[model samples]
Target: AAEHLAATRAGRRAPHRVAVAGSTYSVFPVRAGARTPQAVGVSREVRETVLSDWLLVVEADAGDWAEERLDLLYGVTQLIAVERDRRDAARTVRRRLAQEVLELVQTGAAPAEIAARLRVAAPVLLPGLGAAPHWQVVVARVEWEDGTAETGPVAQSLLEEILVDPHATGPEHSDRIAVAHTGDEAVALVPLPAVSTEHDGSETGVLADALLESVREPLSAGLDGDGRVTLGVSAAVHSAEGLRGA
Candidate 1:
């Protein structure tokens, strides 16, 4: 596998046939580890401008490996690449929105301008939630003992994962969280329905406490001794100025 990966990195586009244990296998390079290959498959180079240092490889059963199978693997790999690109684009847009909002809040931009930006951002972050819903801010920081891990992206991803309500119904419910990274801290903007009977304006602490309840044990296990995760949840804010204060 290492040799085939090297060959692909060195500009070898053709598939390689190799023996593993007692059987013959075909190998292909994949763009990233995220692209899960079948039991038997081919690998393709992941490229943007210059080729990435990694390849996507798929492996298949030796007896079933044929020209048609090869074509099928290639097609599947292409589809995965397309999906990867789409995800990257969506992530870029979300990150930009988060960053912009963070900057505006930090710089004390006009309430009208900040409100306009939030209006634009509402659909992407909160999706099906209607206009001007109450919002909560959750700040998370992950600290590693050796400072080796990249905490910003990791915290952003983890914050999104943690903010999702596993029992919630509807597609848009899971998409109601948006997180931005500033230095080592991840800031999450969460939207709540304007009219939840469970809590009122001054009771955002209830919501905040609930956010960490289910995720705390699992996340603590993952952090273990190597790192620590701390979170500060703010009260619900109704307007752009309120968001800045939160």
Candidate 2:
């Protein structure tokens, strides 16, 4: 299997690839030892350096290898770190934007101002969201065994996971979903394409179902018997008045 994978990826081999359920990772040998072999995985715990020439994980049987593997491991580690950092930075920007919106809503800021903020933050926080012809809100709550999941970043984490599907739109619509966390509950602001009045609005139900179906199982895992999760889907709002209602 390992040889096949290496052959498939342009003759580049990762001698000791670790498998973790749905994910597979590559580790390259760094140094040779009497018994143990020094190697490094594609992952690194240090966020500051983000990449390292040193080995990440030392295994019991690393064969003698040169710096060639070390260079490959370094490049892979850097790529992983860059992706992770991009995701983290995007999430932080979204959270800050959400907080700003919440405050503006409290301070009686004009809808135009709020909309401007959203437009600025949307693409940066949730990529692939173009001009929104229509939008909807999704509200959800999760009750955990110790209630920890409901209180902290877990709610935001769960919410992001639920709304991660960018293509969760109707056949007639050309838009995607953008989600953000508020407080104990997370809210999704989904965009829609132009719809004819002749089309039944029930198409939104399909989206809601998709959201529910994707989250039900993973949510069940994150939650215990003490953990309870409930969600409400607001009617699709084509206008500003409808958004206010949601």
Candidate 3:
């Protein structure tokens, strides 16, 4: 399918451009045999074209402005490429970790085995060996009013958007957090420094609130009835053994 699209673009004489956003791509398909400006109903040189099949003719004063906008569009295209690559890498890591963790929980793997898997999947996101780490788990509930098959893709897309900044509710900081969706729920594992205090109730509440608030509206479009998502945040576990209990 992609090869066919590439061939179509390659056959065109007019400069073709493509822009990507997340998993979707917007492509400008140049009309076949459109070699010059006269073929596309333009008096002056055509500087830019849009997905709508309209040519942006270059004018005297607007040429520079049009060129600048095209440059910005190119930058946006680059950003989209980077974002797609980052998401792909992140998904791969998360899938591997989830599978390893499941094996550890179900088959009772040794701590060393689990740690080895962690190192392979997520070295930077998870703190290295020795001291115990804190963990949080989240589950998503998918609800559709009419119950269409498109709901799944919609939910998946929204989950990706929420993972943009897994931590942080406000616009201040975008905490680098890892995210993975399991079945109908997106299981988000938040790692923090080991906290073993009784007065950490406020901190727990804040974290829970942030997670719920950030995911609420983004997942609302596909939900209906009394359906609402509630995240199950496990208490700070010292080891992989505790993940089994949660």
- Using lDDT, give the best candidate's number: 1
The local distance difference test score of model 1 is: 0.63
Q: Which parts of model 1 are misplaced by more than 4 Å?
A: 1-89, 127-130, 196-206
What would the per-residue lDDT of candidate 1 be over residues 1-246, giving only the tens digit for each residue? 444534443454445556667766666543333233342233421121111122345444534567676666666656766765665456667677778889899898999998898888888866665556777888888777778666776677667656665566656443566678987788887776666654543224226567677666545544545567788888788999899889
Counting only residues 3 or more apart in sequence or on different chains, how many pairs clash (N, Cα, C under 3 Å) in candidate 3? Answer: 0
Q: Pairing residues by index, what is the TM-score of model 3? A: 0.49
- The sequence of per-residue lDDT tens digits that candidate 2 reaches over residues 154-213 is 454455545554453543131134445655666656554344343655335336677777
Q: Which stretches of candidate 3 lie over 4 Å from their true place?
A: 1-78, 106-122, 127-130, 145-176, 195-206, 221-230
> What is the C-alpha lDDT profile of model 3 across 56-106, one tens digit per residue?
222222223454564444444445546555655666655556555655655
Cand. 2 TM to true fold: 0.52
Could you tell me every candidate's TM-score relative to the true structure? 0.60, 0.52, 0.49
Q: Report the error of model 3 at residue 83, Å.
A: 2.7
> Higher-TM-score candidate among 1 and 3?
1
